[model samples]
Each structure stands twice: as structure tokens, then as C-alpha cells.
Target chain A: MKHIESESNASLKQWKKLHSRKEREKTGTFLLEGPHLIEEAIHSGAKLQHVIVEENYQMKDEWLKERFSLWSVPAKLMKQLSETEKPQGILAVCEMMDQPEDLIKPKGRYLLIDGVQDPGNLGTIIRTADSAGLDGVFLGEGTADLYNGKTVRSTQGSLFHLPVVKADLLQIIGQCKEQDIPVLSTSLQEAVDMRRASEVEGFALIVGNEGAGVQETLQKESTMNVKIPIFGQAESLNVSVATGILLYELQRNRS
Target chain B: MKHIESESNASLKQWKKLHSRKEREKTGTFLLEGPHLIEEAIHSGAKLQHVIVEENYQMKDEWLKERFSLWSVPAKLMKQLSETEKPQGILAVCEMMDQPEDLIKPKGRYLLIDGVQDPGNLGTIIRTADSAGLDGVFLGEGTADLYNGKTVRSTQGSLFHLPVVKADLLQIIGQCKEQDIPVLSTSLQEAVDMRRASEVEGFALIVGNEGAGVQETLQKESTMNVKIPIFGQAESLNVSVATGILLYELQRNRS
Candidate 1:
């Protein structure tokens, strides 16, 4: 274990920069807080750079100590690195996950998001996608940063379970078409009843912004558009919840 | 129209008390912020006790002005009443919605929540239930206060559309049993696959705490236990998203 007491410690400065999307993207590294997420990352075989722990912290998990070195941080310094109201005493600095070559491959269920602005919503969508056994998620421009703290926390470690790659939705839809996979978009105008949607072997489901449905261009490009009927008066469902329903319905036919 | 300038005003003090659950319960009133929610409440025929706005704020909606008198407050006082980071210029203090007489009647889709601690999750569940045309939602003990700011906000005005009554789960489940309404609980312990679970016309779906599934007592009491299968590495779904999926699937059989 290495002790770091200074406020301006070099490594601390680098970790602080991980808070910014630009810094995270440029460096290809991010920070994760709490034991649950860290343990999940470990189980997923994520490449952890180092584990940072508050000074005097005891290693209850013997495997953790043997797997990675601990950089002992001052309690105050650890607080600075935390994103939650109550700072968990430990964090892991991890490299950006590499997407598998077959992430965009045909014959698998996938979630395609465009400009889903809320971090919590985006994260929940990713987690739901993982639970649905999605091959990967394609995130397009204007979407929340995959590394945003809220997004990471809301994902509940599913971030490590599946590939969430940023790409153009139109481009991804084109690829799906070429691969003989259907692309579905949610839209009020063009959408048919969700039940009427075909249960194909492979398909990509597109969910969009909280305030807006899928973009016009993307909706037009999809193989079909479906709408979850609002049987009552609420204008719409929460974006993440809507995605979950759509994903579950799509998978219901598979099994 | 009324002007409230002093922070010590009696009504303002009462409004402040609404921030607490005890006060909201005792007074039978709650605060609502933002134009969208306020407008929704107004449209839902929710009794508007008071509509407070910035002194210079103007009501362009003729129906709003004719239906309810406006109370103008200085910007600072309005800020004190606001909960969001960016508060809309208007806020409404409305009467607690009356849970309809036939809320638990035998023939409508329903949701029963047990110990769901997150206000946001509870709110989203209520919103989704409303969207699915659920008759009413029975919120049992240990669940987040429906009047909590986060809960109110997340409901997205669906709060006014449906009856969300606080009750004891066991008692409600007993009533559901008597009414011959099928009560289904989500469980990993003794659950059948959700896809195979029969969706009936009038069923009560019980969702529990984010960490703990339905209470053993409640689970054992349910007519059936169903689980959403995880086809990937993730262990569970976000509570609200799970609720959304359940509500949609259950409703799919209806309309």
C-alpha cells in the first residue's frame, strides 16, 4: 500500500480529471465508487488500474488485496473523489472497456439510444438492456455520457456486463438492415400497436430523449415503429421505464 | 388575487410544513412545482387550494385564472417554496387527491407496492400504472411517501390521474383475495417465469423493495409469484423499470 496525504498529489489530480467527460475520453480511464460496482467490475474481468482506499482501511476481501494494489488516500482526499452524498471508503480506477468485435453483429437483441439526456434514465436503459441479454447498445450523439457518475451508479454494475458503444444511430440502422436484422423505433405518429410488432429473431430497438421520441430521421429509417398504448391520460412513460417495457416485450417472444 | 410578501405569513408557514410527511398528512395538502405538473393537475380536476407565482408572473391560460385565484409572491419567497434546481415560476398548493370509492374493486388492473424506499421509483411506478390504465395503486408501509418532492415530481402528473392509497399489504392482499382479484408478487425465490404467468383481466401485481423482494408474508399470500428472467449477467432490474415491465405485460392481455 502507498500512502498519499497531499491535497495536490499527482495521482489525485489525475483522478479528479476523471470527473470530466473530455478528460475521461482523452485518457480512456474512469473512476468507480463503492464495493458493489468495484466487485462487479472485478468479476467482469475489467482492467483496474489501482484501488484507492481511505487510510487505515482494512481489506476484508483477501482477493482484492492480492488482485490489485491499494493506494491509501486521506479520508478528505477520498471525499473529494466521491460523487454520492455519503462517500464510500473505496474506489477503483478502471480502463474504458473494449467492445467485442461482434457487438454490432446480427442475430442478437440490441438497444440503440439517441439523445437520451438524463444520466439515470440512460443508465437504467443500459441495465435493462443487459438484463434482456442485449448483444450491445449503440449510443448516438447528444446522449448522456456513458461515464457520467449518475449513469454509472444507476447502471448498478451492468455497465461491465455488456458493450455500450457510441455510434451514429442511422449508421447502426443501416448495418442492421444489411445484416438482415430488423430495426424498431418508438414513435407516436408512425408507430403501430406494440403487440402488432413482429417478434423477429434479431432486432434493434431505438429509444430516444425524455421529452422527444426518436429523431425523425432515425424513425423514418427503422424497419418498423411501435407505440406503447397509453390506456390512461398520462402523456407518456418515463424514458427508461418505457425502454424496459419495450425490451421485455421484445424478449418475451424469444423465450 | 392575493399578495404574500412576508416569510412569516401564516399560509407560507403552512406551505413550508408540507415539506414534511407528517405535516402533509395532517394538513391533507401538498405542494406542486413547475408548469407542466401544475397544468396537469389543473386538467385532472385536482382541487387547487392555492397557486403561488412570482410577483411579475402572468397567467396566460384563461381557464387557470378563471378556475383558481392566483397568489403572487416575491422571487425570493417563490424560491423558498421551489424544490427543483431550476424552479418554474409557478407553484400550486393542492388538496390531497381522494382515493376513489371503487379503488380496490374486483375488476381493474392494479399495483401494490411494498417497502419500495426510493421516492423516484414509487413515483415512476404510479405514473406507469396510470399509463397502463390501472384502477388504482395501493402503497403499503415502508414505501416512500407519495408526497415527497421527488415522488411527486417523478409521477409527472400521473399522481392526479389515479388513486394511490396508503394501506397495509397483507390486508389489501386479503381484500384482493376476497374480491377474487388475482394477486401476483415478483419473486426470485418461488417465482415462475413471467412469460408463462397468466395475465388476467383484474390482477394486483406486488413489487417490493429495491434490495428485498416482496416480504415473505406477502409473497406467500399472493395468488402467484412470477419473476422476470435475467438472460444476461445482471442480477436484477431497477425497481421502477421492473414495475413498468410488469404493468405493461399485465395490461397486454387486457386491451
Candidate 2:
């Protein structure tokens, strides 16, 4: 283990740059903080490039002696590296495991997201998909960056548990259709009520933007569009919450 | 209508104090920001005591001429009173509609929250309960304050649309039993599969803390404890998302 006492360390500079999307994409790696997420990454078999811990931190797990390098950082440096108000005294750098679009399997429950702007909402949706046993998550254009701190925190480390593909959702929808996997889209306008829509197996549930909702082109390409009935005075539900209800419903009634 | 230019003004100071829970509780009012929520408040027929706007702001709705008093403040003052990163040039101080505990109707779908800590999660649960047509929200001990800015914002003005009561979970459970309304407590341990729990006409669903799950006494007091089955590696779901799924399932399958 090496001690990184100053931010001027070349390794620390490269780690700090992982905070940016462009740098993360270029290097094919992202930074993670907190013990829960790092532990989760370890369990998910993510390639842990480095694990940075607070000085004299007694935190030890079997994963410590694995392929990942270790660093003991000063409290000040740890605080500087943390995005949250309260630093949890642990951080890790993990390589992104983005799969090629063609590698996406035909038979699996999946979530396809488009233009979800809020990191919290996107992360919650991903976490929900993970809980529902969805096989993968596909991020369409305009969605929040998968490596965003808020998104990562919200996912609670589910990103490491499933396949994440970034590609044109339109093409993905077509490919699913070719493979006989239904592409189910969520819509609030001109759609069949969700409860009435027939539940399906081996499908991809598509959720869209927070405000404008699923794009017209995407909605048209979907095998079917469904809406969760709003029986109360409130106009609508949050996108993440709506996705949760829908994903669980899909699982609950599977024949 | 009044023009208040100075932050030092006694009334402005009083208004600013509403940011604190103690002050909001003492004054029986709370601060609200953004045009959408303010409009929702108006639609819900909430008593809008004061509406503060940015100087020369073009935000003119016919509700402006209603019984509410008005003040035009400077940008700096608006920023001072707003908790969000971007102040929407509007803020309102409206009385809280805390009903006497006895006024809770005997028959209506309800949500009983116990110790949900995150402001955003608590707010989203309340909003989902509203969208699910739940009549009232009974907030038990340890729940985040409804007047919290993040909580209020996450609710998206649902606070104005329903009765949110903060009371003892034990007493509320007793009252629910007295009325013969099923008190369904959510649990992660020693509970029936939620999918198998029969739907009810009028019932109160109890959800507990994000980490602790439902309290033991509350769980024992419930008519039946139920759990959302987890099919994946995720240990648990976010409290708000879990509540959303439960409420919708309750609503969706009602006879």
C-alpha cells in the first residue's frame, strides 16, 4: 500500500479526473465512494483498479489482497475526493464493463431508459430493475451519466450487478423485435391502461424523460404502450417511482 | 398588496424564519417556492397568506387577485428565502392544514409511515400515496418533518392535497383497529409474501425506516405483515419505491 498525502500525486490527479464523464469514458473507469458500494463492487466481480482508504483505517475484507492496488489517503484528501457532505472514509476506482450492443441477450427482463435527467431518479430506477431481477439496463441518449455520483449513490451499487449498454434505443427496440422479445413502453398519452395490458415475458420496459415523457418515435416503435392509471388528484408520479411500480407489476403477474 | 424592500423588515424576518421547523410549527405555516407548487396550492384551496414575487417578474396568474396578500421583493431577498439552487422568482407562506387527530375519516385508503429518514424518500412516498388515491398519511415517530424544504419539494405539492398527520404509531394502529380497517405493516423479516396478501377495500399500509424496517410492536399490532419478494442480488428496495409498488398493487387489484 502506498500513502498519498498530497493532491499533487500523479496517481491522485488521474483519480480526480475520473470524476469527469469524458475522462471516465476515455479511461473506461469510474470512481466509487463509501464502503457499501465498494463491497458491492467486490461482490459483483468488478475490476477494482484501486481502493483508497483513510489513514490507519482498520477496514479489512478478503477483497483487499486481490488484484486491486491500495492507497492510504489523508483525511483531508479523502474529504476532497468525496462528493457527499459526509465522507465515508473509503473510495475505489473500478473499470466500466460496458458491453457491445450486439452482446445483449435475447431472453431477459430489461430496462431501457431515455432522457432521464435526474441522477437520483435514474439511479433509483436502475436499483429497482436490479431488485426485480432484470437481466440488464440499456441507457439511451440524453439519460444521466451512469457514473454520476448521485446516480451511483442511488443505484446502491446495482450498476455492477447487471449488463449496462449505451446505444440508440430505436435500434435496440428493433433488435428486440427481431429476437421476439417484446419492447414495452411506458406512456401517459394515447396508451392502454397498465393494469389492462397483458403482462409479458422476456421483455424490455422502456421509460422516458421526466417531463416530456417517451419520445414519439420510440413510443411508435414499442410493441405496446401502457399507462399506470392515476386515480387521485395528483397529476402524475415521479419517473423513478412510476418505473418501480411498473417493473414490480411486471414481475408480480408473470405467468 | 405590499412592497417590502428591506430584509430587516420584521414581517420579512418572520417569513424567513419559516425555513426552520420550529418556526413553521409555531407559526402554523411554512414556506413554498416555485410557480408549479404555488399554483397547486391555490388549486387545492390552501389559504395562501402571503405570496412573494421577484420585482418586475412577469408571473401573473388570475389567482394573484384572490384573497392572498402579495409582496414584491428584490432578487437577493428572493434568494435568501429560497432553499433550492434556482429560485423560481416566487415563494409563498401558507398556513399548514394540520387537522385534529379525531377528524381522520373512518374509511379511506391510508399510508402510515414510521421513521423514514430521507426527506426525498418521505416526500416521494407521500406523493405516491396521493397519486394512488390514498386518503390520508399518518406519520409516526422518527419520520422527517413535512415542512422540510426537500420533503415539501419532493412531495410536489401533495402536502396540500391530503391530510398528513403526525401521531403515535401505536395509537394510530389502535384507532385503525377500532374502525375495523386492516392495518397492513410492511416487513422484511417473518412476513407473508406481499404477492399473496389479499387486496382490501379500505386499509392502512405501514412502512418503516429505510434501514430498520418496521418496528416490532407495530409489526405485531398489524393485521398481517407482508413483504415484497426480492428476486435479485439486491438486499432491499428504497423505502419510497417499495411503498409506491405496494400502494399501486393495492389499488390495481382492488375488487
Candidate 3:
């Protein structure tokens, strides 16, 4: 195994660049760290560009040895590349593929996040959407980049399981309408109880920003406006939690 | 307003100590930042030990000025006291209150987190449990401290609305059984679909850790084991998202 000792090494510098969204877009690659994430990424069949492991990492599992080309690096350099406090001694560089254009076409149950800026919330929503079998997720302007380190980590490697596309809010809404898909937008005001809202066969569920909800124009064009019922003193549910309940309820009704 | 300029000031030192769980417990006080959070705490009538504002912060709101005695601190000191990259110019010292004794007596649905450790996940679960109108939340050993800064922030003030208590798992389970409240625990294996599980008039929904999940002993003692149906390739839902869906389903079924 070839070992890169210096943090100033060319490859190490390049790896750090991938942490930024612009660099991830420029290089068409992203970093996956830790054993669990790397294992899940491998299981998802995401193309592995390179695997970097510390010199002392014991590869007791024969399966991992056979799957990829491994390069050894100093533990310190690995820590510099890792987002976690304790570097897991294993990291993988994987190619980032654009979501297929055909799949991005409005179909089945879709989620559109408009300006949901919290990376953890956005990531959890994506994971929930994937678990509920949503067709795809559309990110409107102001939404956190899907490849952000926190977002990727929070997804728990679910990013590879679903198509997440960044698109214009108005444009996507129009496209859904053209495809005969209704847009069910969640709102705090001017919305019916989610349970009582009629479930459309093929519709898109739109979740909005944390502080301000779905935009006025989007709400005006929405085919249905729905809200989760609040029975307690809480002013509102967390955006991600609301998305989870709405998606689950929609899936339940459809099934 | 009285002004304190030094980092070594008694109140500044006390606020800094709130960054750790041990300090929060020892002092029986926690630090809360941001205008919205401070407002929520004040609205909840939680004892306010002190309110710190930057000297440059204009006193724009009459109601805020009337509510508490405000102390002005330098911007540098305010930054030192805040955890966020951008401090919101305000911080509050809140007195910790003991869990309500009556919370142990179940009246409606409740949530029990067996070993959730992530501060964000714990906070989200608490907020979700509150939104679902659950009776209370039980934090088992190994769970993140409820008063931890991140957990408190994540609750979005729902922490004050819900009766959250920490206890011995076995004892709490026994008490629930004595009250005739069924306990439903989540598991990936050997669990029935949450949808198919019979709805109990009064029950407890138990969520486990993000990775290891509920301990075997807790699962065995549960009245029933339930699983949220997953249709996509993603391995599992985020713990908080799962809690939201499960609690909502239970609430939906009962309604």
C-alpha cells in the first residue's frame, strides 16, 4: 500500500477541496468517512474512486480487501480529511453522479424543499423521503446543498438510495402540473388537517423553510394545502418531523 | 441596564460553564441563546436568573424591557458565551426545574427513549413527542442530557411544554404496566408493522438508539414490538423521524 505522509501532499489538498460544494461540483467526487458510512456506500454500489486507510488499520475482513484498491496514509493526514473528531482510519472517495433527468420528471410521491436551510433537517427529510419510497426530492433555492458534510453524515448514507435534484421552485411546480401531478404544500395557515386532506394518486409534497414556510406564490398555486394537527402547547412541529409524518400519512393513505 | 465588561465576571464565567452537561447539572442552570428561545423560556415562566444583551443592541421592544432586568455585556464576551458561529446578541440563564411527580402516572400516549445519545436526535424526539401530544417523555440511561445546550435548542422550547423525566428503565416499565398502559417498542427485526399493531387507549411508544437500537431486555419486556414499514432501499429512518411517524400513526389510529 502506498502511504502519503504529509498534510501538504497534493491528494490531501484535493480531498479537502471536496468538502466545499463548489469543489464537489468541479471534481464530480465527494468523500465518505468512517467504517459504517463506507460500508453502506459500498453496499449501495456507488462507484468508489479511491480508498484511503491508515497504516495500522487491520483488514481482518477478507471481503473489504478484494473490493477496492487501498492506499495507506498517516493517521494525522486522515484526521485532517475526516469531519468527525475521532477519525475512523478509513475513508473513501466516490464519484458523484447527477440525478437522472428522466427520474427528475414529476412522478409518484415527490418532496420539494423550499429554503429548508438546516442541513440536519434537510438530510433527515431526504432520508425519510427515501424510507417512504418517495420518487425523488427537489431542492428549491436557499436549501442547503445535498453534499454538505453535515447533510451527508445525517443522511446515514441514504443519499445513494434516492435521486435528489436541485431545481427552480416555480419551474418544478409547473413541471409537476404539466405531468398531471398535484402539489400538496404544507403551511401553518390556510391549510386543512393533513389526515383529512384527500390523498392524490400522484402528487408532490412541498415542505418549506424553518422560520418562514412555503412562499406565497407557491402556496397560491398549490393544489392542496395541508397541516399536521397540533394538540399540545408546542407552536409547531420541527420541519423534518412534519415532513416525516406527512410522507408517512400519504404513503399509508395511498397503500 | 447594568454592564459587565470582563470575561472573568462571575456571570460570564457561569454562562461559560453551561457549555458542558456536568456544569449544567452541578449548577442546576442552563444557558439559552437567540431571541426566539429566550422569548419561549420567558413565556413558559421558567425562572430567569439573568438576561445578557450586547451593549450595542438597541432596546427596541417595550415588552422585553419590562419583563426582566437586562445586563449589558461587550460583543466579544457575548460571542464567547455563544455556541453558534453567529451569536444572536442575547442569552438567558434559566433555572432547572424538577420533573413533575405526576408524570409517572400515564394518562395518554407517552414516549420512552431507551438510549438515544445524539443531542440533535434527542431534542427532535422531544419536540416530536410534544407535537404528538404525548403525556410525557422518559429519558433512560445513556440518553443525552435534556439540559445540554444542543438538546435544549433542538427542542425549540417544547422541552418546557412536555414533562420529560429520567428514570430507571425497569422501574418505569413496571409502573406503566401497573397503570395498564401497553408499551410498544421499535425494532428492525422481530417487530410487527406499526400500522398493524392494535391501538391502545393509553400506551407508551419506545424509541431506541440510532445505531444499536433498543436493548434486548427492553424489547423482551415490551407489551408489543412494532416496526415502521420501509419501502425504499434506505436501511432505516432517522431516529427522530421514526419517532414522529410512529407517534403520529398511534395518534391517528386512536383518533
Candidate 4:
């Protein structure tokens, strides 16, 4: 196994750049920390560029040893490259997968996010979408970067399970209309009760920013606007919670 | 309106003390920041010791002005007391309400957490429980204090909407039993599919730490063990996400 000890190592410099959205877009790769996430990425058949394990922490599993390109780095160096306080001693660089054409076509249940800035919220929504067996997710402009470290961690490694694509909302909505997929945007005002709304077979449920509901433009363009009935007096549900409820409702209705 | 400008003022020292859980416990009050949260707290009828608004922030809303004891402080003072990047120009000192009796008796549905250390997760869970209309929430030992600034922020002001009490696991379980509420604990190895599990009209769902799930002792004591089945290959759901799914299922079953 190759060993890296210098903070100035070329690969380390590249990993540092992965911390930013611009760098991730430029390289088409993202850094993932911890053994659990790394293992999940490998198991999901994600294209991994390399695996870095802290030199002091050796992998006892023969499976990990046989399957991937392994590199050892000093513990201090690993900490510098990691996002968490206690580095799990394992990290991976994985190539970004292109959104599948079949998955991207508007069909079945999908989540459309507009300007959902919280990385954790974005990741959780993706994981929930996958769990609910949604077809895919589309991200509109100003949404959190899909490959952010916090987003990856929040996904609990579900990032590899489903197709998540970033696209212009106007274009995607137009395509959905062409494909006969209903565009359902969630809003607080002038929205039909989510429970009472018809659960069409194929629909894209759109969620928006925590502070703001869906954009006025998107809301105006939606085929149907629905709101989750709030019996209690909460100003609004968390963006991810709203997504979970809507996804669950869609799954329930379809089943 | 009362105005205080000095950093070393007695009230300022007390406000600074509230930044720690120990201080909150000793004083039987906690500090809440941000306009939205403070507004929610007021709406929920929480007893406010005083509200400190930045001098430049005009209180045009008669409702906020009429209800609470208002104080004005310099912008710098508000910044010093605030946790976020930009102070929202409002902060509150609220008297911690006595743990409500209804919260101790598990009725309908409830959530019990054990050693959940992440403030964000704890806050989100509380908010989820409230939205789902759970009877109450019990914080097991080692969990992050509910009064912490991050925890308060995370609740999105939902902390004021539900009864959250900190207590021992064994005692809480016994109380649930006395109230004839089943205790359901989540685990990977022994859990049946959560969707398939019968919903108890009055029950408590226990979630454990982020790294380690429900403690073995608590698991052994639970009346039912359930798990959310994963269709995809993600390692596990975030604690808050898992809680959301379980609570959603419970609410779904009820209706």
C-alpha cells in the first residue's frame, strides 16, 4: 500500500479542494469519510478512485483488502483531511455518477427540491426518497451541493442508492408535463389538503427552502399545489419532514 | 421598556451563565435566541422572564410588545449573546416549566430517547414528535440537555409545543407500564418490520445514540422491538430520519 505522510501531498491538496462546491463541480468527484460510508459506497458498486486508511489503523477485513486500491496515511494527516472530530480512519474518493436517462424521465414518484440550502436536510430527503422507493430527485438552482461532505454524511450513504440530478426547474417541469407526469408543489397558501389530494401514479412532489415555501414561479407552474394539513399551530414543518410525509403518502396511495 | 448597555451588568452575567446546561438547571431557566423562536415561545404561552431586543430593531408588532417584559440592548450586546452568524436582534430568558404530569404517563404515542448526544438530532426529534402529535418525549440519561442553545434552535421552537422531560430509562419504562403503554425499542438484529408492527394506542418508542442504538438493557426491557426495513443498501438512517419514519407510521396507523 502506498503511504502518504505529508500535508502537502498532491492528493491531499485535491481532497481539500473537494470541500468546496466549485472544486467538486470541476473534478466530478467528492470526498467521503468513515469506514461505514466508504464500505457502503463500495458495496453499492460506486466507482471509487482510491481508499485512504490511517496508517495506525489497519483493516482487519480481508474483503476490504482484496477489493480496492488501498493507501495508508498518518493519523494526523487523516484528521486534517477529515470533516469529523474523530476520524474513522478510512476515507474514499469516488467519481460522480451521471444521472441515468431512464431514471431522469418523469415517472412514478419523485422529489423536486428548489433552494433547499441545508446540506443535512437535502441528504435526509434523498435517503427518505430512496426508502420510500421514489424514482428519483431533481434539484433546482440554489440547492445545496449534492456532493457536500455534510450532505453525504446526512444521507447515511443513500447517495448511491437513487438517481439525484441537478437541473433547471422550468425545463424539468416542462418535460414532466410533456411526459404526462403531474407536477405537485407544496405550499402554505391556496393549497389543497395533501391528504385529500388525488394520489396520481406518477408525480413530482416539490419541496422548497426552510424559510420560504416553493418559489412563486414554480408554484405558479405546478399542475397541483398541495399542503400538508397542520392540526397544530407550527409555522411549518421542517423541509425534510415535509418531504418524508409527502413521500410516504404517495407510496401509500400508489400501493 | 428597560434598557441595559453594559457587558458586565448583573443581568448580562446571568445571561452568559445560561449558555451552559448546568447554569440553566441551577437557575431553572434557559436562553432562547432568534425572532422566530422567541415569537413561537411567546405564542405557546411560555413564561418569559424578559425579552432583549436590539435597540435598532423596532417592535412594531403590538402583540409582542403587549405580552412580554421588553428590554432594549445595543446591537453589540445582542451579538455577544447570540449564537448564529447574524443576531436576529431578539433573545428571551424563559422560566423552565415544571415537567408536566401528562408527559409522564405515556398515552397515545410518545418517544423516549437514550443517550442521544447530538443537539441537532435531539431538537429535530422533538419537533417531529410534536408534529406527529405524540403524547410526550422523555430524554434518557446522557442525552444532550434540551435547554442547550443548539437544541433549542433545532426544535424550530417546537420545544414549547410539547412536554419533554429528562428521566431514567427504567423509571420511565415502569411508568409507561403503569399507564398500560407498551414500550417499543428499535434494533437492527431483532426488530420486525416497523410498518408491519401493530400500533399501540398508547405506547413509547425508544431511540438510542447515533453510534450505538438502544442500549441492550433497555432493549431487553421493551415490550416490542421493531425496525424500519431498508430496501436500498444504505448502512442506516440518521436518528432523526428514523424517528420521523417511525412516527409517521404510527400516525398513519392511527388514522
Among all windows of 10 consecutive residues in model 4 chain B, the one with the lowest summed lDDT is B99-108
CAPRI-style docking class of model 2 based on DockQ: high
| First chain TM-score for all predictions | 0.95, 0.94, 0.92, 0.94
lDDT at B129, model 4: 84
**Model 4, DockQ value?**
0.43
DockQ result, candidate 3: 0.81
- Write model 2 residue lDDT over A1-255, tens digit each, in one string: 899888799998898888788998899988899989988988877888999999988776676667888999999998878888898989999888746456456777878998999999998888888888888888899999999888999999888877777878988888788888888899887888877664676888899998889998999999899888887777789998899888888777652
- Put the candidates in lDDT order, highest first: 1, 2, 3, 4
The superposed Cα distance between candidate 3 and the true structure at residue A252, in angstroms, equals: 0.9
Residue pairs of candidate 1 with colliding backbone atoms: none
Model 4 ranges off by over 4 Å: A60-72, A104-107, A197-200, A253-255, B1-7, B60-73, B102-107, B189-192, B197-200, B253-255
lDDT of 4 by residue, A1-255 (tens): 789888888988888788888998898989998877777777777888888888877676754644567789988888888888888998888889877874546466678899999998999888888877777789999999989998998888788888899888888788788888889999999998776665577888889998987999999999999987654445667888778777766655443
Residue-wise C-alpha lDDT for candidate 1, range A1-255, written one tens digit per residue: 798899888988889889999999999988899888988888888888889998877756654654666799888999999888888888888889998765667687788999999999998999999998889999999999999989999999999998999997888898899898989999877578887775678889999888887899998899999889899888899999999888888777665
Worst 10 residues of 1 chain A by lDDT: A59-68
**What docking tier does model 1 reach?**
high
Q: Tens digit of lDDT per residue, candidate 3, span A177-212?
A: 888888999998888888876456777889999989
* Number of the top-ranking candidate, with lDDT as the measure: 1
Clashes of each: 0, 0, 0, 0
Worst 10 residues of 4 chain A by lDDT: A246-255
Enumerate the chain B TM-scores of all models.
0.94, 0.94, 0.94, 0.93
